[model samples]
Target: MLEDKNQEKTSLSELGEFGLIKHLTKHFSSYHKTTIKSVGDDAAVIDSSEKQTIVTTDLLIEGVHFDLSYMPLKHLGYKAVMVNLSDVYAMNAEAEQITVSIAISNRFPLEALEELYAGIQLACNTYNVDLIGGDTTSSTKGMLLSITAIGKANKEDVIYRSGAKPTDLVVVSGDLGGAYLGLQVLEREKQVFQVNPENQPDLDNYTYIIERQLKPEARKDIPELLKELDVKPTSMIDISDGLSSEIMHICTQSKTGCKLYEEKLPLDPQVISTCEEFEIDATMVALSGGEDYELLFTISIDDYDKIKGNPNLSVIGHITEENQGMNLVTRANQEIELKAQGWNSFKG
Candidate 1:
């Protein structure tokens, strides 16, 4: 008789794409009554019932997406939900529900999972979103989280990246680059801890910036504010992938160009001071640092007057014809072409 080989292990890389998908979806079955179609198709079709539905998803991986050593499971859970909701807001829609799935290893304790759920529940309550359903599984490696957020919007009110036109004013909400600088502070402190276990982190001066990194809030109010002002964004995207990269995305999709002014870029005082302390260039940080979670949008020139004086909004540039290309003008009056050094997970 042949020996039993049921205990043999297989590598994920050996299975490749199709085999991996099969392995993952093997035990998953459609449980929702509204699910018209589930996996095995190019796209999953759902019953819309004449209502426009918005879909967004986010992926969080260990080490790359977060550092478990300093990041509490609760904050990690809250941030996972907030990041996807930010995308819904970018679409000018109201987020109503989310489905969360997690893959974890045996190293995590049951209490840790509970702490993570607590944070997720807090965010759901705060945003008034329903945690519809999800899947839990064992991972061969580290923790991985994926969230899919579903939102609703009227067909007429939906905003897309293709609506921007030349001469429209470019605007941004809140400040920029604080989160990236905060990460720098945290990493520096972590290094110190590794070198000397007895040394306590000097975090008093970096409280504001550090919070910006660990706990970023989505700009859910921007959509309501635009409605109150009787203005709709011609084009918009959240600033998760650095200011310059997001601006390029809007310009590319809208078939337009832009001229952003350095003097007009908003920076919090704490961000500037932190950059100075770390001996890093503030301008570079403002332009290329990611995870700000602010809104970058464009509006018709006529509507500029309504938003110009708004404390939460700042006009940083203006849209131009495609031939003009995207450029940034420095405070010294020199113009330079903008290039995006946004996060590339594969590269690093």
Candidate 2:
């Protein structure tokens, strides 16, 4: 939107790196008592007294992880934070701080960065995490963001991917496949725009899916909700990679196998209908679509009654002995070998 409007563009050189950092992070304030120091420091300090600290980092690059033609800079900033925070929440920890580093080319002006930082600040305020410290540098090509999120949890409360037991039930929060399908819609629209710039694509049917892609929220409430329900997950992971890939991560690390049922996958109504429109199998989308950001976890079957009626969670399947191997139970009652066909950066 900023690019479309003819407005004054301030050069980044006027602010310098330190000046720009100070300006961008001026609105950020610390919420957690653990944050000893926030922005404008040599290094941000946190006092995680008695609690275990969780740290997670993710890198997103232009023309690779995203396309600026379709992706807004503000949404990109918000999403960069959410992606890392999602990893922290996967460990059942509450994210308290994040240090965001970015490298941008000269094409982005001061106002452009201000818009990006506005989104970042909004995420911090919304999620109640502190913007601690980071570095800024000039890039030769395009924008690159690397965010490191810090979280805290009691030693006994932290969940690990290797903690799943054979009899534990596999559960997932919210729905799957919406974000991936959203990307498909956006990509299609981009192609259409290239062919006809004046063509206005009808996107009313894709509102939910598009929102899911642009502004995915990390499941910060899932851990708190589970604690409120007195249900601790045996093992947990956020659905960033596809369902099958993440499931395999848990199973391999835990030395266990799984039986994921195709029918049990939680799908939004839009996701189902969109899959039909795209002529893609909904089951395949649920299995291999990435960036859902929902938490997938395992719980002891003994606690089944507690969460049986929860609408936010879907009990997909159960863990099995390692020798049984990971398999997907089709709705037709046939077993298919589960494969990790999710996103792979190096696959040419």
Candidate 3:
């Protein structure tokens, strides 16, 4: 009986493409009004109605973008969806559905894939988004995930990265650098385990930053908060590739300049302490440490009071004329050119 049970264990080849898709996606159900047809079809049917649709896709490679040694499959699943949805929210739209495609090597068993889907389901439930459809395939090497998020907004409410003007106030939601610092802690612990396999890591000190890396949440509330406050962002983006790179993107796309104050950059207390322990500059970490997933936006200076003292928002800088150039004003009053040093998946 044990031999028969072992033989009955299904492999990717045995299940084939259609069989695997049916088995895995059977538990998923649609929850969005726009998701007219989810799964079991040639394509996902979305009823956009009178609203404009916003779509964004992101691909994460195993070895290049994430190290599976430290990143659990479940967290990877949740983070994948969050990363794509962040882009949708950045456009000031509401994410309604997502299509998740994955390529996994034969080494992954059916149960392992189930664990990944569990996390995906958790995220979908938390954000109230529908799992419309996706593809599953075999990979020659490590696992890879590609997620495409679809959102909607009125034509007048849609925000773009190129809408910032001079004199606009620059704002960011939540503290920066926690995710990058979390990566550092994880890498260090991984090395320690490699050298001494018996040593159990004490991760209590790194809890916050570690969560920031492994299970970062997208800012799904910022857009809603802006709507409640009657404030429309002139420009916006999610801080996936570091604040410096994202700010540079906004400035370049808007054909404007910016002055970012070093002191005004938000940092969690844990991030600050971790930087001190690692002897790293917190300011630099906040500027170039990517994967924050917070929303960075620009608003009209006239509407500043609505968000001025809100704990969830931080006013970090202001837009400047194109001729002024992008500069960082240090605490000591030194002006320096800002550069983009965020995470580069293609970097060798």
Candidate 4:
């Protein structure tokens, strides 16, 4: 009793990569004169002129990126925008606009969509960013969100990943691994709740770590502080994939190595307690736990005075020549090769 007996459906795989690109391009027409080229190059080239531009994009999928069981729609929306804005800050730029697109299944009610948008609006208000154009569509499965953020900076202010030099001091904003420990607490509580329905999970003790995981904030103030201190980082990267991975990225890109002092790795008291409770190595967590969203950068030794005694910052390591390789000097005075075991989605 179907209404459209002659209708045929096509699978995304059937169209292949090139075909899908063509199909999507057909629906869009260029409107900006600054778009020098689009859709068919190794990268999109724009006529930025005298102004410096920053570009960042993020993709959030159901199950992998979030869980409806604990993640609220509004928080998810806010987080989506915040994650992109963090990238803008990492580039030392001011985020001004964002384009959000979502693919949702029919299971989501209109009220749910409204709740999500409310979060997005909150982020826009907080960051002073405009809600630019985007698209909505029906998904074959669950919900998916993709956002592209654009920001601006002065020509001289833009930061890149390859500026680190030997002997520069490595610094990080905020503590690390709290977010990972927080997630662990949430998962443990979820398991406990599953074991007994009548028992309400007691998360009163793990509030700090849990909040660090669920509502992580980008280091928005670091850029402003840098300007005030007149210190430009020799190289910088955000701790999205853990400090070890990010440090490796900076070192590899700059053709340098580093020696991180284990005692210098910052850890919130809550993170220390939680890691102990879980019987996980706190140092390993600080090294490899992701989602801290802190800034990891290297500055010339001369700039050390600018950040010294700053409660929000810590000097963790020092860069070395590439031939020295990356190592961590433990509190026990043992040198161990640093390993980047940052979250790998494909490996589960």
Each model's lDDT comes to 0.85, 0.88, 0.88, 0.84
- Please give the ranking of all candidate structures by lDDT, highest first, separated by commas: 3, 2, 1, 4
lDDT of 2 by residue, 242-332 (tens): 8998898889878999999999999999999999999999999999999999999999999999899899999999999999999999999
lDDT of 1 by residue, 1-348 (tens): 455565576655556443476689999888776564344321133446655577788889998889988888998998898888888888888889999999999999889899899989998999999999999999998898999988877767767766899999999999999889988988888889899989988788888878878888888999999999999999888888799988888898789999999999999999989888889988889899988888889999999878878989999999999999999999999999999876655443
Please identify which of the two predictions, 1 or 3, would achieve the higher TM-score against the true structure: 1
Candidate 4 lDDT by residue in tens digits, 65-96: 78877788988898888888887788777888
Q: TM-scores of all models? A: 0.87, 0.86, 0.86, 0.87
**lDDT tens readout by residue for model 3, 72-140:** 889989999899889888888889999999999999999889988988998999999999999999999
Clash-forming residue pairs, model 3: none
TM-score for model 1? 0.87
List candidate 1 stretches off by more than 4 Å: 1-50
RMSD per model, one decimal:
7.0, 11.3, 11.2, 6.9
Regions of model 4 farther than 4 Å from truth: 1-47
